[model samples]
Target: MGREYRCRIQGGPDRDAIRQLREGIRLDGQVSRFERIRHQGGRGANRWYEVVVCEGRYREIRRMWSAVGCRVNRLIRTRYGDLVLPRSLKAGQLRELNRAEVKALLRSVDVSHSGRRSSASSA
Candidate 1:
């Protein structure tokens, strides 16, 4: 139902690998590494692969696979800490914080539009 593959480089994965993967998917859906880069076990052992999914709807990554005759099987989100939506924030739901919290947040922002004149002006 699915395919899985791993690529172990000599120094582990890096931004270039990630970029190549993204570009490959964007252009042709095929995912692979640079020829010069070495992988563990070599050949079938280290080479990446594709998968065939039965589902109709696919995600952003899956859409890229359409160009390469391969389907993404395993996807690990590495930036969930910064982007993942918290359950506390609900759709169409807006809540206000306490006065102290509001003040703290506003204190950081430079609101020159407050229109408040300086306390000490020319005599």
Candidate 2:
């Protein structure tokens, strides 16, 4: 599933630089999708981005931005596929997903029922 991010970066990265970063992600064969939504704040430094990749590659987003010469000051994952981080869930707090929610999440990521059952059973 893809994720949306609001990132605070140090340098003002132009469109060309952002394109280069996208290319880098593609070259690495890691990212399935990469998009820069917009840059706000002074000098267009802070950016909003959306990316789709195989699971467990969230950290790579920071690395890719850093490799392109932008230091990420803040990175907030606002969405993961159909799951949005609830405003009520404060940092360090956890929320358990109900059965329907869990099923939807698994469907979003294309996980088979057997896979889900096996994982659940193991847990």
Candidate 3:
């Protein structure tokens, strides 16, 4: 769940461009859908759309938009799966957690093999 991503509003002024970008990504990447977000920038009169992708590859989305001559000015990863950077954590600061917290994470995984083993033993 530590996957990285590049997020952007593809294409220029035409509002429909966002829709096109969404469709293109689905077709090219073979994904069914991606979550869309809207935000108001400090200097802007209109709203902006942000696209989210799970797979992280540097500038992957930006390069895709650049293929059509569109520029992506803002790119930031706001979330990484279940882990969200704490608001208190600044740019260069870091937080170190104990080993128990790390091992607890593995308990969260739902492996299908466990279910199969239980069923076979009960038979």
Candidate 4:
């Protein structure tokens, strides 16, 4: 599961464009689920969208949006796999991941890395 995002696009997307984007995403076959996509609001030529896609599918989501005549100007991943970017963590700040967080992150993408121990032992 993932949270929604508020994205800024070059042009406002109408309902028909959103429909086309949905179709494109489905055709891409990389998305397991596109939970939601809506025009939250906009100003001038910039459009705001609230989108919820399956975890690990943000790239596909961006591609689909582009294919449907929307150029994404900015995107912020509000959530990923039960982890939310903390409000206090400003840009460029670093936060070390705890063991559980690391484990969950790896599990989200179905990846298992045994770390540098195996290489060290071999060396």
Scored by CA lDDT, what does every candidate get?
0.36, 0.65, 0.49, 0.69
Cα TM-score per model: 0.25, 0.67, 0.51, 0.62
Worst 10 residues of 4 by lDDT: 114-123
TM-score of 4: 0.62
**Candidate 1 residue-wise lDDT, 18-63, digit = tens:** 4454444343353432222223333432334322222223354444
Off by over 4 Å in 2: 26-37, 40-58, 112-123
- Please state the error at residue 29 of candidate 1 in Å: 26
Candidate 4 per-residue lDDT over residues 5-103, each given as its tens digit:
667888776787777655545545553445778777788998888787765454665676776788888877766676777767766776898898888
Clashes of each: 1, 0, 1, 0
Q: RMSDs, each prediction?
A: 14.3, 5.2, 6.3, 6.6
Question: Candidate 3's residue-wise lDDT over 2-119, tens digit each?
Answer: 4333344434535455555555544345532334534334344323445566554556566655644567666655555544556576657778756664444443343233433344
Highest-scoring model, lDDT: 4
In candidate 3, position 19 carries an lDDT of 59
**TM-score of candidate 1 versus the correct structure, residues matched by position:** 0.25
Q: Model 2 over residues 20-100: C-alpha lDDT tens digits?
A: 765555435655335444555554545544444444364776777776777788777677778888867776888898898
Better of 2 and 3 by lDDT: 2
Q: What is the lDDT for 95 in model 4?
A: 86
